[model samples]
Target: MKALYFTADKMMELRDIAVPVPKKGQYLIQVKVCGICGSDFEGYMGKTGRRTPPMIMGHEFAGVITEAPEGGKFKKGESVVVFPKPFCGTCEYCKKGLVNVCTSGICMGVLSADGAMCEYVAIDEKYLIPFSPEKLPYDIASMTEPLSVAYRAVYKISDEELQASDHIVVIGAGTIGLLVTAMLSYRKAKHIIVSDTQEFRLETAKKMGAHTVVNPASGDFEEAIKKATDGKKCDFAIEAVGISATAESSLDALKIGGTAIWIGNAQKIVSINMQKIVTTELSVRGSYVYDFDGFKKCVELLQNKVIDVSSMITDTYKLQDGVAAFKALENNTDGKMLKVMLEV
Candidate 1:
């Protein structure tokens, strides 16, 4: 099998490697499509230390099952989507159903474990979900991870007693931001505002159902958001960019008593106006990756065609062109990139 491997010198190389055998209680999947993620790019650029090099680099993926446990729910040669997160079900966090934050959680492709970049991956049988090819395409199935992340963000809003179609603001117009906007649209948000410095991404947001797109680099974004909402402010604000500035922007866009959710990976710290938060009675929270049920719900949504993830795929590259795909995603070249997939 040919795979792209991260090297000790921080390089990507395509090499032939031995195919892995499925152990007892594990299922082997022949990789069909694997999407390049932002975190992967960060690791390649030495921004994130999750992957130390000499590792496979694909987690968001879909494939056909080549092997499964006897009498398992999935059959050999069955099409399916892989849930990237592997949890130790006995952990305290897993006991509470928060598998995403489990202390012993192991994520394929991004961590120490072997990922899906290769032609085949052997995963735990319990982490595999049967998918209908007629219902969901392999390319779209590769987006299950991002969609699940988006679902988890919306799930956090459930405790606030907010209604669908409420005024909402989503900061950042990247992949997650765009996907989150689509999820919010599915929830029937009446007014959805997306903010970003890049005009092209903002335009994509509009096509995806954002009612308003703001360029924060040009002027006062908070003022523009307030004016658009008639001063009532957004009922909910979600920060999709993993940075302090965007997090603050999300908080600033919220109305009094409204809630704000941070779903992005922010490595640095951002100062918040504590006085304003207290006086306005605002609630700010952080949301991590999806729980077990969130991944299942994401699969259901995709299988039902509730969200058009197919359009999110901007480009596809062969496994040999993996380096090119990562570079394009990193540079955002031609404004022609969204979900870049490796055809393994």
Candidate 2:
């Protein structure tokens, strides 16, 4: 089997590896597609500590079942998508059905474990969701993890609040950001404002249903956002850029008594207006990766055509070309490239 691994110096390298067999409660999948995520690039650059050296690097993958143990729900030749999150079911958080925050949770690819970057992977049956390529293509199915993350963020929003048709701002027009905009559009938001420095990504956001797009790099975005909204301010803001500036922008755009959901990982501590939160009653929430239900719903949406995950994939690469693929992602060379897949 061929696998793309993170070397000691934090670069992706293709190498021949041993094929894994299914354990008692696991299934062996013949990997069809694996999408490269922003975190994957960060891990490649040594910014994310979750991915150690000498490990396969991929988590969002879909494929056909090559082997299934006795009594498992999946059988050989069945197509499926993996959750990628390997968590202990015995932790306090897991006991409360919040397994994503389990104390000993380990995400495949990002952790020191063999991931879907290879020709085959032995995954636990509990985290696999069977699907057909007829509903969604293999490359789109590879995006189930990140789509699930965006879905979980929206799932956390209150139902009553969703019905309020409040103005919403999504920072960053990347994969998760675009998906968040689509979800908000489906939720019937009064206005969906997407902000990013890249005009191409902003245009992609418009195609995905953003009512307003702003280039934060052009000028003071807060005033533009305010002017665009007629001084009403966004009722809900989401930070998808995973940086200090975007994180603070999410806070600055929110209306008094509104909610700001930070889905991005802040590499450094970001200053915030805590006084405004105290005076205006603002709510801040941190969203993690998906749980079982979130992944299921993401697949359902993809299957039902409620959202188009396929269009988000703009490029593909073979395992041998992993280095160039990651480099293209880093440089943002292609216009509006949302997701890149590695063909194993």
Candidate 3:
């Protein structure tokens, strides 16, 4: 077996390694396609401490089962998408169905756990979700993880609040942001506003169904939002950039008492205006990864063609060209690249 290892800062190496043997209840999957995430880029740059060196770094992946326990629910040769985060079913959060934030949950590829950026990986059977290859291609199926994240973020707001929101702002037109915008559009959001520093991303956002796009680097972002909303500001804002400035922009773009959902996790700590939030009665909610049911729903959405993800995937590369793939994402100054996939 071959694996792409994150050896050091801004470095990746394809090395030969022994295939992993399936654990007690794990299934051996032959990885087909894996998507390079923004967090992988951050780990490559040594920004986020979540990823350590000499570990395979990929979570968004789809594959075919090569080995499975005898008489298991899922048999060998089945196509499946992995849910990266394995939770302890006995945990309090897991018992409450909040598996995304399970107290004893650990995300694969984030730390010591090697991920699916290789020829094969042994994953627990509980984390595998079957998908039809005829309906969902491997490249698109690999996006289930991120799409689930987007779904959870948008659905964090209640159905009443989402339907009543006449104006919604999405900060940062990254993968998650663009996907969030697409989900909102699919739900027929009245007006969708997306902001980013890159015009290319803003253009892509428009293609994803954003009614208004603002480049915060060009001029005043709030002014653009006010103009887009007719000076009423936004009824809801979703922050997907996890930076201090963008996080603050999400809060500032909302009208009094509006809700803001923070989905990005790049930064561990971000400063915001507590006074404004307290005085204006604004609500700030943090949305993590999707629960198990949410992940299954995203797979269903993809299988049924309810949400089109064709536009979100911008580039693909061979698994051996992992270094070039990471480089393309790192040097994406023009922001033409959105989601980069590695074909194993």
lDDT of each: 0.83, 0.83, 0.92
Residue range 6-101, candidate 2, lDDT tens digits: 886547788887888666788889999998877777778777576788888888899999888888887999999998887888888888888888
Note the residue pairs that clash in candidate 1.
6-54, 165-189, 165-190
Model 2 clash pairs?
none
Q: Residues 50-121, candidate 1: write the lDDT tens digits.
A: 777889988899999988788777889899888888888898888999889888767887756768888988
- Superior by TM-score: candidate 1 or candidate 3: 3
Candidate 3 accuracy as lDDT: 0.92
Alpha-carbon RMSD, candidate 1: 1.9
Q: Per-residue lDDT for 168-268 in model 3, tens only?
A: 99999999999999999988889999999988889989988999998888888888889989999999999998989999999889999999999989899
**TM-score between model 2 and native:** 0.95
How does model 1 score by TM-score?
0.94
Clashes of each: 3, 0, 0
User: Which candidate comes out best when scored by TM-score?
Assistant: 3
Error of 2 at 86 (Å): 1.5
How do the candidates rank by lDDT, highest first?
3, 1, 2
